[model samples]
Target: MNVTGWQRDALLAVAEVVVLAVILVMALLGNGLVLVVLLRRRRHHNPLHLFMLNLCLADLVVALFQVLPQLVWDAKGRFPGPDFLCRLVKYLQVLGMFASSYMIVAMTVDRHYAICCPLQAHRSGATQRWNTFILLAWGLSLLLSLPQVFIFSRSEVAPGVYECWGNFAESWGLKAYVTWMTLAVFILPVVIITVCQPGPAASSAFCCPLPKAPTARGGEVSAAMSKTVRMTLVIVLVYSLCWAPFFSVQLWAAWDPDPPQNGAVFTLLMLLASLNSCTNPWIYSAFSSIQLYGKLINILCLVCLIQTLYFILYM
Candidate 1:
């Protein structure tokens, strides 16, 4: 528990540095490929594609601005260069985290309407509505995370060290904010998204819930339904399982007197959250079936997510 021992934190710090560096490499390369493909393909006009492309772009920023600095700061016990840089990183981290969560929910909603409200979904104005929805999601994310900028102030805690997510050690309001932020950022999003997923209806929406194999008449119903179910289950399961404990731990930290035992528990929380980044992309790659669009989606998602996960871990 004593982080005072140089050797104890040093080795772990070195590992963090290496891992974060690797993560940045993967993120930049993967997302860059995705962004290029998305732009050149002229697919950004599609609502889903538009949202996804922007999501990748946002996560790309997250990797560079958040993950890279987190490991370096942790390793060195302070950030190098200007104090503003530390604040900038932390602020962007909050922004990206919130934006990613919102985008996921938005994706779920888009799919839900496409299936559950198919008639309206394919109407002439559907495309325009989708674009508006994408804008709303981005705007909302920006607004939601703006408070972070106001909250963070760069501080030099030692001769050469700077801290950003600091001073929350005393303010009870900050703890409460963390508690709520965790719930809003992680808990509620997963629930709403899972429930709103566009999977095939089981036997009973009213009676006995029975699994029904989708009956398709040359449409994407069967395939889309199956993918929806598989993806919904996988994404929700992983996100909830990994993040629930992290949020719980934060809640505990907010309310309880004990610090995390050896910081490993918190680090574990970080690891699980980070897992979402890499694993989510792979999930898309594996789950999207054989559609032509699968490859692009997988590449974009993987690139963005892997980088995002790195920061979640190192941050």
Candidate 2:
């Protein structure tokens, strides 16, 4: 039986709803778990952990304010509510995205200082500095996202249906903004993260201060530090890969005034970007000692792998 055009659209929409629901659930729970674990261990509030906690908070905000609304909007087939809410959704989503990106940059900076300049890191009162940086992250994110408030308004989708999308003064203006945002928010951060990669020797030296100490325990500590560095490197690499496609697609759209012929590819890129928010917690769990969390991470990894394979086949 041949599927009618509207029927195919409805089925595709339903599939999006299902996938988005799964993403929403994982993002909320995974990030919430990180927050709970960190907050419970308040005594271990080093600057790195503090920044990580903020990352969790920022991811949760994205899951709630950004992805959740998209899920609802998908199900309802329109941007539900008043003009104010449409603008608010657009604004908050951009804010969450900026906050998440900036927090990662802060973490990279904090880690760089800790590993590369331990003496200065020890003297700087990290807890206080990180707190200030967290505040700054939020402030900067809010400021950066302020343009969304002015650029986005409710536009008619159908006769009675409305949706929120960027309403820039000119196409070139929107393209310019996309290009700038993609570079500043995503590409630049990845470059900074790569530069901040702590060498094994430096990390070992910073972690195990006594250079001439017992070889066995020191070796183990050094090994663990090296493993952590490797894990962090992989996490950053994954982050870059996951986000690069989405930004590249946006850049293409900016240059070529037409949408790509392969719409599914664009959707898949977006899904991968959303998946990044959920994947970070699992990446953390993979490097953690908690057996239960590690098991959960393995299970989640399997699920994600299966989904990824399905996405590949579907595309």
lDDT of each: 0.64, 0.77
TM-score of 2: 0.82
Q: Taking the candidates one at a time, how many backbone clashes does each contain?
A: 1, 0
| Deviation (Å) of 187 in candidate 2 | 1.3
Stretches of candidate 2 above 4 Å error?
Answer: 1-3, 157-160, 200-224, 291-315
Model 1: residues with Cα > 4 Å off, grouped in runs: 1-4, 43-46, 156-162, 165-170, 199-217, 288-315
Measured by TM-score, the strongest candidate is 2
Identify the candidate with maximal lDDT. Answer: 2
TM-score, each model? 0.76, 0.82
> Per-residue alpha-carbon lDDT of model 2 for 147-221, expressed as tens digits?
888888888767966778677777588888888889877988888776677876645654435334355676785
Query: lDDT score, residue 40, model 1?
Result: 82
- For model 1, the run of ten residues with the poorest summed lDDT: 202-211
